[model samples]
Target chain A: MRLAIMGAGAVGASVAELASAYGHEVTAIADSNSAAIDPNGLDTEAALATKRASGTVGDDSPESVLEAEYDVLVEATPTTLGDAEPGYSHTVSALERDRHVVLANKGPIAERYDEVRAHERNSEGRVSFDATVGGAIPVLTTIDDIGRSNVTAVRGVLNGTANFILSRMAAESLDYEHVLAEAQDLGVAEADPTFDVDGTDAALKCVILANVLFGGGYALSDAAVEGIREIPGAALQLAAEDGQTIRLIGEVVDEEIRVGPRLVPETGTLAVSGTQNIVQLQTERAGRLNISGRGAGGDETATAVLGDINRLL
Target chain B: MSERTDVRAHTVRLELDDEPGELLNALGPIAEHGGNLLSIFHERGNRTPRGRIPVEVDVEATPERFDRIVDALRQTGVNVVQAGAERYSEELTVLLIGHLIETDFSDTLSRFERCSSASVAEVSLTVADDATDASSARIRLAAHAGETDRALDTIREVATEKDITVISPLTGGDAV
Candidate 1:
């Protein structure tokens, strides 16, 4: 299979690493540099080498990214609406050219799900963005297959920044800033960390899930967004005293969606033990399906990216 | 697109007292005049030198509803510093430079709602690998006829408060 990646971020590079390992041809890798500056877009081997050399990735060079035509296009850019980023054009362009798509990036799909789905309908394409919403939890597949229609609601400890901070607060009694810095250092959180700390990331992820599992496209305004910055450390302490841990939760009730930090009793399943993500899928038939694990580890993300690529094959 | 001769949208720059309930008070008129709330992204944590928080709200209402929302906000003792309607001729594009992944780029879009008149037609992102860094974006701000410039201006101002850079085509070969 010939592959084309739309972004060169951690997720994108990881996907490249996996698909290439499987003996597929990753023809091109792209990023937001409209200039197309670097000539040699890093190959999987080269991507790993680059990361090994500097402990960071360097792919999406102009020459290597636009190397050749591809059998598929992978959407791996960061999620944002409108002209704020790159990859939407690359995805649409590949679709227009009749390429299969595997999406790990959530922005275009979330912002223009209808438009892109229509594009998919018109192409020889199938999409799997399993890594987008649930991170390493595979909530999308779970919702799509195993525990689907019987599902009632889902609550996510979606943002790693917020979750990690909460975990550190519980374990070391650390403040938000210190834990946040640690999260960044661990490469589990974004530098800005606003979306994770805020309810925006989880809210958007909920909208994507809701649109897929539920019906009408959710109104962002209707889906409340409250970041974790305002959540005082003392609040977590109080929750801990009550045998609970604070988790930023996103869920749909009746129709209205809730996104905020809440205290879950330690005895309850929803109470996250640490920064690891815990997603509860409440169903009428199956009861509660709690998906818990390390949500943002690099290897975990890479493996999920590989999983999406396998789907492409 | 619901474009009326009477109602047009303008960017309202507000210096909200860094306190709770202030946002609710500021939003009275917007909801009252049937000013369909397009989006309101309050930088609750980012305070101005005056110790007030900056808030940028985009509304899609008829001219009357828009004015009423503005008026309502003022009447509630909410400080309304700047207000002007946006008239656009072309849909412009721009890039946002910052830790977009870190900033929850999704919330930024939540601040941009969709209405029959104008909405965010498209969006894309480029995340860096190291993760302790900034990403760039190319956004297409699609708006009603003669409303593009104002939309761009409002979005740029919102980016400023969030500490993100806006890269776009020049409007009128000058700042709006």
Candidate 2:
């Protein structure tokens, strides 16, 4: 398969670098401002090196990649809410051309599922976004194998940044601000950590899961979200006294999406520490299934994007 | 008479006024209702917030007899903290964080207890070193089976009115 990756960030760059190892050719690659395109297959290393040195992927305009020849379009753009612009438009452009779309961006699917599905219904292309939810955890694929109807509920610690701060606060008896600063210093959290700390990131993942589980019509506004910012160190201490810990949990159950700080048993499945992520699925016949792994990273998330591309094969 | 006559064990928690022959008076209802007394765990030293002794009585009775025994104990003025396995069978633990002292923590607890589907079972509160700082309380609630959602809804409503944050347990899963 020939791939055209949007967004020259970590995930997209990793996908471009690893495409050949997976027996795929990179026909085009685009950052926000520039693009590198070759119908036969472009030099992946040179494009990445140019991006590092000159802050541009190539001399070509970013819009040109959308018109380039490619079998799969990988949307690895930064996630945005409300309109879910560039990502949604990029997805539509691929489906419009009947080319498959593999998404690492959660904005399009989380905010506009029905519209995307509607577009796919009219095209010969198919959409796969295994990277949207739990990064490399294969949450959606597991649901697909189990049959979405048979999966009754999905819940887990979906955000790694929130999990890191909460776990550190519990372990060292530190407050939220102190641990969050440490996380930022460790590069586990971004300097502007509002998205992860405010629970919007996890809620977006839950919204996508809800869309897959219930077939559509769910968005960020529909979710009931509460972040871990207001949780004091005393709260973790009080919970620990009772053999429990506090984690930012996202749940998709009873046809509703909810993300908040929940009290889970300290040793329970959902209490994953550090930057780890876990997803627990309640099935109708086979009981509960748990899948845990590194929820975010360049290679980890790119592996998920590549997995979707493999399925497109 | 073709009803559920098979004997089953049931546990009932009761609060009794510390008085002479109070235990004897409480046991009279079980025997009168045709329930076989299994055992009595009478905690004489520990007293409830209402200054009443807590007693846990296990009885073997038919489903019909168990219901009658519970009703009889209640009608006879025995404070039935919890009765039968099905009633208040679900236990939910949540952390309430905020200015608990300034917000009247006692009133918050009373509001939870006033809800018909649930009752407060245990609470552990911790205040920060600075008196005016935010405090946290771990409240354990025993709710009627399948009423866990309603119990949580009541807590959320009260928390919202008091400007408190509730870290609820993950419900409808094994975490509960």
Candidate 3:
């Protein structure tokens, strides 16, 4: 399969390398930063160097990811709402050109949910975002497997930075600032974690999950977001005193989606502590199913992106 | 590097029933109020470790429209768990010890979020320097000023509950 990547950042470059390894023709990669992909393929060592130099290697203007004349396009720009100049532009171009789309970025897909789906319908091109919600975990794929079932609700520790901080804080009784600072040092949290800390990142993820599994377009503004910042650390300890832990969770019911802190009972299957994401599914048929995994490491996210490229090929 | 004052964004979480068109029903308010959508993530196949899908979203709009969007969304008969601009104001870090792999620690970090004027800023792990069960990670957290105390409180609680050891701030916020 001939392939191109919409961004040359961490996930994008990783996808390119994976495609090359699987013997797929990764024709072109776009990023104003530096050319990570060529007609032959990406230089894996060079990409790693770039990743090391800059945490990400995305181009503000990435026209090449779209104009590559490839069979498939993988969009992997950093997610942000209302700023889809390159990714959105490239996605539409790919679909219009009659190429399949493998979306790893959530910003544009979440915003233009119906428009892209419409394009897929009219153009008869397949589109999938299995890597958008879960990093290496099969959350989206699993949802795809159990399609068309009415999902009662969703609750999870969708964001890793906050959960890591909370876990440390709960255990060490450290202050918030110290934990976050350490997280930055560890390269887990961003310099400005406005989205992840504030709950927008997880919210966007929830939107994708809901749309893909539950069906229909969702208004992101309507989803509730409660960051871990305001939750009293004492509250978590109180829960702990009772053999429980506070997880910043996202919950979706019939007409509403919720995100905030929840006191998960320790004995329940849902009560997973730390960076691992645990999911429960309640289908009328299956009753309830549990899924858990690593949510936000670079390797994990990159691995899943690779899986998508492999599948697409 | 956008203008914070002019840039209006909100984070919200809601409790919705598992019914048809529930997602569309929730989104109606944002569109009706003229809010520009950013992103939406939904975990549908799996439950909330307890049983429920947690849908998250990011949106942009005027302050007035933002209020309307939230109002309209709640009016759609969904449970609005929490809402706000969610600004962070503090930071901290700590280390953990014990057998993390055995406890399914991967699921542990995923349960927390960057709220409370805080965020998980960093993480460093010593893999027992071997495959043996002993491993440790030093975690960093950032939150609103003075919120570090609460954040540390949360970590200590989680550590005790999970049976992980907390290394130290050793000193205070100044040390970090």
Model 2 regions more than 4 Å off: B1-89, B130-133, B144-146
Candidate 2 or 1, higher TM-score: 2
Q: Pairing residues by index, what is the TM-score of model 3?
A: 0.60
Candidate 2: which pairs clash?
none
Which digits, one per residue and each the tens of the lDDT, describe model 3 over residues A111-225?
7777778888877567877777757777777766776465555556678787787787778766567888988898778899878777787788787767765565775776877
The per-model DockQ list reads 0.01, 0.42, 0.02
Candidate rank order under DockQ: 2, 3, 1
Give the per-residue lDDT of model 1 (tens digit) for A1-313: 7777766667766776677567676666655542122223435566556555665445335434433567767777777755424656656677777777777777766666666777778887776667777777888888877645677777767776677787777778766777788878987677888877877878877877776776446545557665666444544554455355566777765666777765455456655655677677777887667787866655566566667767776
How many residue pairs clash in model 1? 31
CAPRI classification of candidate 3: incorrect
lDDT per residue, candidate 2, B23-95, as tens digits?
A: 9999999999999887798999999998999998877677789899999998989988887665668898999
Q: Considering summed lDDT, which 10 consecutive residues are worst modelled in model 3 chain A?
A: A55-64
Candidate 3 lDDT over B1-176, as tens digits, reads: 12322334455665566778888888888888887666576767755654556676656566777888888887777666666545444555555565755665544443223223234545555554455544655555655567677776776666678876554332210110
Candidate 2 or 1, higher DockQ:
2
Model 3, residue A204: displacement in angstroms? 0.7
Candidate 1 Cα outliers beyond 4 Å, as residue runs: A34-43, A47-67, A82-85, B1-176
What is candidate 3's local distance difference test score?
A: 0.65
